[model samples]
Target: MTVQPYVPEPLPPAGIDWEAHIPRIASANRALARYDGILQAIPNPRLLLSPLLTQEAVLSSRIEGTQASLEDVLRFEANPKEPIGDAALADIREIINYREALNTAVEALKTRRLDLALVCDLHRVLLSGSRGMDREPGCVRTIQNFIGRDAQIEHAIYIPPAPEDLSGALGDWEAYLQGGELDVLVQLSVLKAQFELIHPFCDGNGRIGRMLVPLILYDKGLIGSPMFYISAYLERNRPVYYERLLAVSRDGDWNGWIAFFLHAIEEQAGANGRKATAILDLYDEMKQTVPEVTRSQYAVAALDALFKTPIFSSAEFFEQAAIPRRAAERILQQLREHGIIAVLAEGGGRRAATYAFPRLLAITEGDRL
Candidate 1:
């Protein structure tokens, strides 16, 4: 017997039993508020939190079977010629696309609402020059698609709505996004699960769905910016994440999924808060350290540039730090000697060496140096 496609019910799914989820909802909200407070306190969140964003892109893509690590992506960006192999390079590009797509959406959200047009725009950026580029980026599926372990529909785990139904389904989803709910965080849980169930795009549905988490939070004014990093939690709990989503479609288990999602929000928000606070503290420490080590007027500028791009080239650092040629070279040597930065690749001839701020990178990776 063939498996029939799963047609999702319209948004605001009935019988959610929101009353039972009150405790989870409250906890999730408190944790998220605390995280947002940390974000507000950061002097330059976009710069300091950039590595976290990249890590999110890596983990989100990893959930979809990509094999690149956070360090792999950063090292590649610092020097594209690193012989990490074609397959690894491909994965890195996908991660890069994820970051670009996210940054694009954040900027677009500044002047527009989170609607389908903007979503399609993000889809285009997401799959550009990547594995799914041929799968019709920026366009909704015009044919049937399914989630399965094999190509045979008989072995499918889940099948999304038929192509003919996508427009109406998505329209309803967008309308629900604009309306109010019992609680914004619980409402977000619904929105995310519904999008995953709908499986709107042909190849990037999972990633795009995850991307919406931060975007929605920002658009709803829950965060100072679209910088939340929830993928770490989801990726860590990969099996349960999918199980909760599937449970919603399989058994009308919205409350269960909402409870799980709220927990994810609460837990990841605390983790994100701690990581962000660590980065801020390191920045404060480096302020005095860089000045003392380099004893240069450009020490603060150099420190800021490092946080913005922890892995950078010597030439790139000079330009970004905006120090004079000789002075910047001296400062790099001083930082290298003092173990403030480590050389990832050495400069030779016209090729500038790559460096890594291991302290900052370790904090972003949630690892000790």
Candidate 2:
């Protein structure tokens, strides 16, 4: 049987209880205000930490899909110890893939408006090979499905509007963004909620919803880049995440969900900002001591990718870093020379030696999940 898409019913006649979410709205505003202060106060002094936070955000978001216990996922992410189960492993890989999509989306945002095309591309990247979306890359789901408490699949929950609705909705979102009537952080929450309510695609609705948040922010000139990830925050607050989403559907509680969503953003943004700051400090300290004279300028980028995937081998390094084989080798050595990283050889030429960013790897292995 084909895996059809899930969609909520059309906007109900009673209208959403937009006002009921006032408390969340207030809290969200406070968080966003705090986050904005940090964003303005910390930069250049913290620019380099962007890659690390970006990697963590993307990976943490993917972990949310694993259905793993939130505590377990956070434990694994904070300091992965003992091999994770196969399902969790799969989710981690998916998260890593999302990070790639995020990188692409962020770069694209810099050059183009955050239109449906960019959103479609993000869906394509996120749902590239999953059973969701029937592997159409960016196709929307025409059918409707639902998830019961036991993970039971139910059809006929709600039918999604035709693909044309997506274009219309996205246009409205873009207009609101351009008008500056809505605050950037609050707008991101509302836009993400609206996108999910629209449920444009037949598959990967959640992932796409999450991706839309940062894309909107980046496009609106809110964030310097797409380094913040709400998945971790949402996953931590999964119960409220689902409840508020449903509230929007049941009572049109837009204000509530928007508030919660913005709060998620504010919280994640600060966490990301701090994480980025720490990583940047580490990178700068390493740079000052490393003899830059011998390494390519690209080495810094390679190091960035290290935090992105702190436990990979050289082959994996070159792929994400997008550097040539020989240059990658030279750069790896440079990292080792600065004591920023070390080799993990299996000895006796029996296997390929692996490289690890010792401190960053340690953090992933023991902290910052």
Candidate 3:
């Protein structure tokens, strides 16, 4: 009985094989377009649902190994310090970081064009104060790093660029950006996938890769808003996502990977649409009911705040809803009575508990978009 020695294959020079991945790309884009249609059909204020939806998408990636349910995430929002069953305060903080990063990336996209510099900024937000720093945000790796879970190490699956390769690869990337030859959406999707394959940072590759999709879309003007998200679809189909990524690298399975990606776009777009429609409806219902329940201007203001962020605290509600502290507190009670938002456990010593729009919360946490 003899053991065979392991042999490493030559690495494919960094690039995508679009010709081979065309069918997959077509199918995936079809899926994405279908959902985009759904999103476009929905009405306003409801469009605000995109952020909450994006938050769920980000959390899905962050808590990848935890197996924590959606309820756990929403619960963490109110009681981040005491989320149920194994998720720690640190996890809650990570979730909040993810939300902030998504917001940062999306807002930047909406406001202006994206640059490699912005990529660095997004990584800065993502890995902020984490152990992974000490290196600059987009600083390419000088050596290989292993990705894996716990002692097993198999999950360790990213490779940042060698420090020397960083500038050249980014140079090529910027050149492509300026060439303006590729379709913008196609360019964004391909560029993101390529970025992941390049894996230029020692940490934050996944989040940064995901962030790039929307950023590029915004940069290209395909979307004025950051409504599209891939984290949920990728996290949900983790095995397939990884397989496609690797397949494109080893087997020239770009078509398959692109199709899968486009499918993610399609499916996620539809899910976002449904959530958006539901969110808008929820807003109208709340507005109609609020006046009857409480005639205060605070009610109107709280409704406005919900569009910015669907959850709130007495302090936040008081600050944004523009009512006396006591009046703001009472309005929340009325809101609860009207089933607008349900209270969650309090933390951070705010005296008043935090609350979430549980139905909206449910849609955010639900399976399938």
Candidate 4:
């Protein structure tokens, strides 16, 4: 027997039993608000949250079968000419593009509306110079697409909307995004599910859908920064992640999906808050220690760069950290001597020596890296 393609019904599923989810909704909102407070208190939220951003990129891309990690991306950026394999190099580029795309989208939301144009533009940035470039990065699909083992739609596990139907569905999605009065968290949960069901673009739908979580939150003023790390939760609960999404289409289980999303939000928000707090504390300590240890006026800048790219090359640190070359060298030496940064390689002739901040990496990776 052949399986039929799954086409989701339009938005605002009737009779959701919203009252049934009141507790989860309230908990998610409280967790998010607490996280937002922490974000507001950070001196420079972007700079401090930089490593967390990279971790987010890594986990998000991981969901799409990309093998790159935060370390891989920083190391690749540190020395693109290194002897890494082509496959690993491509994966690193994809991860870097994820960061670039997300950063671009967040910056755009500062002055622009969150609509299809912004989403498409973000998709363009995501696939540019990566493996998915040929899949029509910013363009909505003009052909049917499916997710599963078989190329034939009949054997596929899940099939998105027919290409011809995307315009109407996406239009309704964009409108609902702009006109929802439901609690923003619940609204965002539905929006993510709907976007995934539509699978707007030919490629990068999963990644772009995940990216929208933070984008929508920031756009709606629920979070001061778009630094929410949600993929970690989804990746941890991988089976249920796909199951809930499938249930939404197969069983019209919007209530169950929204509940799962709320639980993810609540749990990930708490974890993100703890990680952010720890990162900020480490940054504050380093701010004072690095300057004193290096005895260079540029120590603060160097420290900031290290926090941003904890695993990087000495040369890249010198050039991109916005510190004088000589001062950067001195800071690097001082950091190494004080056990703040560990040298991964001692550059001999032409190779740029690599470095890593163990404490910072540990904070972000949390014993996993």
- What lDDT does the true structure give each of the candidates? 0.90, 0.59, 0.62, 0.88
Report the lDDT tens digits of candidate 4 across residue range 1-369. Answer: 654555656667776778998999999999999999999999888888888888898999999898887888877888888889889988888888888998998789889989999999999999999999999989999988888886777788888888888898999899989986678888899999999989988899999999999999999999988889899999989999999999988888999999999999999999999998998999989888988898887877888899878889888898768887777888888899999999887887889899999998888987332
Q: Compared to the true structure, candidate 1 yields what TM-score?
A: 0.97
* lDDT tens readout by residue for model 3, 12-94: 22355657656655665565556555556555523456546546644555534434344455455534344254445445445
Q: What does candidate 2's lDDT look like per residue over 1-369, in tens digits?
A: 422442333322134344665566566656555555555655442234444444454445644455433234333443344367677765654664566677778678667887777778887887665444365677655444444444445433333444645566556655665555325555566667767767776666677777667667657665655545567677668889878876765666766776677667667766755554555566666665443633576766675576555555666677878988888878777777767667664323433446666665343222243
Order the candidates by lDDT, highest first — what do you get?
A: 1, 4, 3, 2
lDDT of 3 at 166: 60
Kindly indicate the candidate among 2 and 4 with the higher TM-score.
Answer: 4
Off by over 4 Å in 2: 1-64, 67-93, 133-135, 149-179, 292-309, 314-350, 362-369
| lDDT-best of 3 and 4 | 4
Reference-based TM-score, model 3: 0.79
Assess every candidate by TM-score: 0.97, 0.69, 0.79, 0.97
Model 4, residue pairs in steric clash:
none
Minimal lDDT window, size 10, model 2? 5-14
